[model samples]
Target: MMGVVLVAGALQHARVHAQAAGFPDFTTIVEKAEPAVVNIRTTAKVSARSGPQGQDPYEMFRHFFGPDFQPPGGRQGPQQNPRNNKPRAEPEERSVPRGVGSGFFISEDGYLLTNHHVVEGATDIFVTLTDSREFKAKVIGSDKRTDVALLKVEAKGMAFLPIGSAKLLKKGQWVMAIGSPFGLESTVTSGIVSALGRETGDYLPFIQTDVAVNPGNSGGPLLNLKGEVVGINAQIVSRSGGFMGISLAIPIEEAMSVVDQLRASGSVVRGRIGVQIGEVSKDVAQAIGLPKAEGALVGGVEPDAPADKAGVLPGDVITKFGDKPITRWSDLPRLVGETKPGTTSTLEVWRKGKPLTLKVTVAELKADKTAAVEPTPPKVVETVTTVLGMEIVPVKEDVQKKLRIKGGVQVTAVQAPASTAGVAEGDIILAVNDTDITSPTQFVKVVAGLDQARPVGLMVRTGEQTRWVAVRTEK
Candidate 1:
């Protein structure tokens, strides 16, 4: 009987130990994280009537004869003077109150950090501290692309969190989040960093985690184990409209970089290389004599742009830009966008069969606003028939004028190649075997000289739109 009791006691002890090991005490972390997390209350004066056009006809009648209606001048209505009659209280003007979002304190002198969507178009922004004190805030600056904003309050000596380098973060690292989620103030949750360098869209590169992020946690901090701010909880991926273990946070490094720029200037400025590129595929790798299909393959270089001026040709493959490794095509845009214009940088590119180094001055990228044009006549190469019924020749000047292209190949005619591939005449050819074609001669050389059977990419400019089309060669 004594032996049985000892075994049961041991089992109970082990269960208790397991429970204790599973849960971590977040008291200190929460205490440190709470001061930085703030509740954002914004008020916008929405015109009661959506203008004179949307006014309800019945509203005018109700305003005239309602029980609380008052004639413009001072007047008193008949009052019932019964045994327990009391004077009716005056009706007050109705107001609409709205509550939303959260933010964090970033400076001791009352500067706060939050998402642009939080206070955008807000007429009045009120910030509530962890101690329940409130202050009015003003917008200092905002970057819509990064969704980051800087705000200023009238208070000083406020508690703020120090920024930490997100570059050092790695997957599986423990992270803590503090914010007002679901109107619950100072809610704290903990989880591990699920991934790093996550690109949700081409514009947003976020830190992925498993933290429980909800509605009001939009601009809250994702704290590292050392009590430093590593990322800003921004978005989540879920089907049930709630946290299903997938959350995305803006890396503190990128956020801070934008914040610093916004604080310095009213708008953010990004560097441009003036080249359109795509990922290098396995077939392109073998054709280019590369050991692996990594790096960005240049598709087209804008005329007279920094890339063109620096002699960055269409057939060159960019392996590295400055000190950052261009492992994939998507990495180039983000890295270049983060750099400032006029900055001179070194580019490591694979030209022909040898690695070449080129120095380039970054240029300002302008928004694409030009309309597309139709393809021009081909320069007349020995017309080759692919499995597709189209007849393709080299691009010509008349084709360039018809296509409105500064440089590229034109589709001369459509025969079996067109019917089989569904490509019609007037489709300009931009790239073949990942090699860009600027002139008819280059296009002919690239397509006819290729020895492998691989799909070719074409940038088709039709009407007012441009689209990427991939066409396979004859087997």
Candidate 2:
């Protein structure tokens, strides 16, 4: 009887312990994490609508109603309301609220993180903490490609959450988010990580979750049970402008790297090898002798670029960069973009049904390196070749002078990919992949030299404005 009682007691204790271990209580986490979360508000400048072209109210009334329409007060402006005997208010212009988002302190000195879109073009920014303390914040820098932004508030000894790695996170792991959803400050929501390495952006492998993130939660922190921030809540997959179980967050590792860059130089600089890459289709993979479909398919290598100089050829599928696996085409971009320029990275490539290793010194993207300048005309035109299904012709001197452009190519005809890419007649090609088009022949050669399996960026000038169009090519 004594042995039976002892056994029953031990079993009950074990059951209680199992229950405690299986479900973690987030009360402690909430207490520690809530103080670090902040609500962000921004304002933008806007011009007010002009009342009427003419100052005279009677003239404006006559122009709108009729030639002989009478004014309300007999040739005067709006009259007083008869019921209240009060003058009516006129519409006035002012700066208005632009956006609302959430952010969290990353350092005790008040450095914070948020989404770039939340603060882009904002004229004024304000942040509010859990204790109802508000501070005007400055935008340190923003990287649009990664959708990450850094901000600094004028405060010291601020509460901050410890950073954790999203790489350590697993699917079905419990996580929580603290944010301001639709302006509800200090709101908390919990869920399990739905997935990781989600290909949502070319430069980010997002951490997907089912947390009830909404509009104002754009820049909040996604925390683990330990109260450490693993990701920055960013995007939501929704059709009705509300959270419908799918939310995405930027991994903390990537966010921290971007924050460091933004803090140092007001902008993020990313490494580029100047090769256009596509996905390795199953058929292509099989044809190339791979056991399974994987890796980034190199389609176009820009002339004189780092990849071209490093012997990275067209049709070579990149299996790995440095030691990171390129399981998806998008993974290559994120890896390359995170790497520092001038770093000699080893690339494992699959070519001719065999593996080849190549060394590529990464180069900084031109847009991030220097401010854009107008191109000077070249004295001569190069040989002609065709790609992207566009007939190229040298721009007439008269047309070039009239358009204020030194040199360009005029599109004579569009077919196949060009037609589908919205290229039209009379559209002047200003540049190809950031290289200034000196002449029609040069433009043709540039296009022809491009691999047909890649997308070509064409700077098309239509009328007085110019825009970039990525022309798709047949793979």
Candidate 3:
């Protein structure tokens, strides 16, 4: 009976252990990450007018009661002095503004990281430590594009967290966040990584998680299970402008790169390929005769760009850059931004159903360069109504000159065939019925060759590039 009791006790102990393993004890992680997180407060001095020349109340009252203060023009009141009425030396009002944010310590020597938006235009910055000690902070550098800022405080022996590799993070991995939200200091939250390579349309790809991030959580650290910061809490997506279980954190790998660049040069210099790329959809894949839609499809190449100089053309699918696989379309930017300019990198692309390799010398990205413009629009001539249910006009020289194009057809009015095929008024038709058209005669002939009820492919140039649009001919 004693032996049976021992067996039962062992089973009970095992069950208890399993239950404990299911949940992580985040107390230690919070304790370690909290000290590095700080509250940033900024104050701006506003100009105020010196108090109104010390108004003499006794003299003003006596003046109002004087006999000369008799009712002015039958009005039962003293006539106001024009000098005193001249706005009473309007007190100058200047706004003294204040703001708050959060930051994490990156170095023991007092280097800290926060968002550039937090410190931009700030006149005075004060950092409050976890222990409630405050110190004035100085901005070391700030990168507006990445929104990363480096700050320094005059304190020694400060606790800092080591940066973790975001590349090693996987979906569903546990993470924690410590930040100041709504002026509350050292608030800790936990959640699992929900997704990766999330594009928030801000050009910075982020790691998506379900962490409970709030307004004041920006620039806080997202800690991994090992107590290292793997990401920087940056933004959240919600209709109500608050956390709705969706949060985005800048990957530490990218954030640290920006931080290092800021520390070195007070700004970041990103490498440029000078090509516009779009994701290869299933339809595009089928059109391009690709086995699968897996790579970034080049839609346009900037003139004189590194990609252009390397003979990278539209319709080429970029499969790899250097040693890294171009798994997603968004991955290219992060990789390119991290690479130094003037570096030679190998690019693998698929062109015309065959793999091609090219060596490209990355160029320094010019901030103010304008994107490439497409071919000019064709002029409108005799309007011809087509079975596509649209009125097409012949190319005129004036229209081409106005559009600054060498050749193409100008879309005047789009109806069934054109509108249904996604053609718009400003679109310049470059090809119709698979025949290149530079004039109205050629355009009409190409359309005449198309069979009714069959799909006709038309290449239309819009904005900066040309895209193929398929429209069904009228029966």
lDDT of 2 by residue, 345-458 (tens): 999987655788999999997653222324333333534335578766678788788766778787766687887777776677777764678976677677778666656766
TM-score of 1: 0.72
lDDT of 3 by residue, 65-154 (tens): 233322224343323455654442445543343446789999999999987777776778899998989999999899876778899999
RMSD per candidate (Å) reads 11.2, 13.3, 12.9
Candidate 3: segments with Cα more than 4 A from true spot: 1-21, 49-97, 314-317, 346-359, 368-379, 383-410, 413-421, 429-459, 467-475
Scored by lDDT, model 1 comes in at 0.70
- By TM-score rank, best first, the candidates go 3, 1, 2
lDDT accuracy of residue 150 in candidate 2: 95
TM-score of each: 0.72, 0.66, 0.75
Determine which window of 10 residues in candidate 3 has minimal summed lDDT: 55-64
What ranking emerges by lDDT with the best candidate at the front?
2, 3, 1
Off by over 4 Å in 1: 1-23, 51-99, 365-384, 387-397, 401-475
Candidate number of the best TM-score? 3
Residue-level lDDT of model 1, residues 1-22, one tens digit each, is 9999999999878777866897
Candidate 2 displacement at residue 10 in angstroms? 29
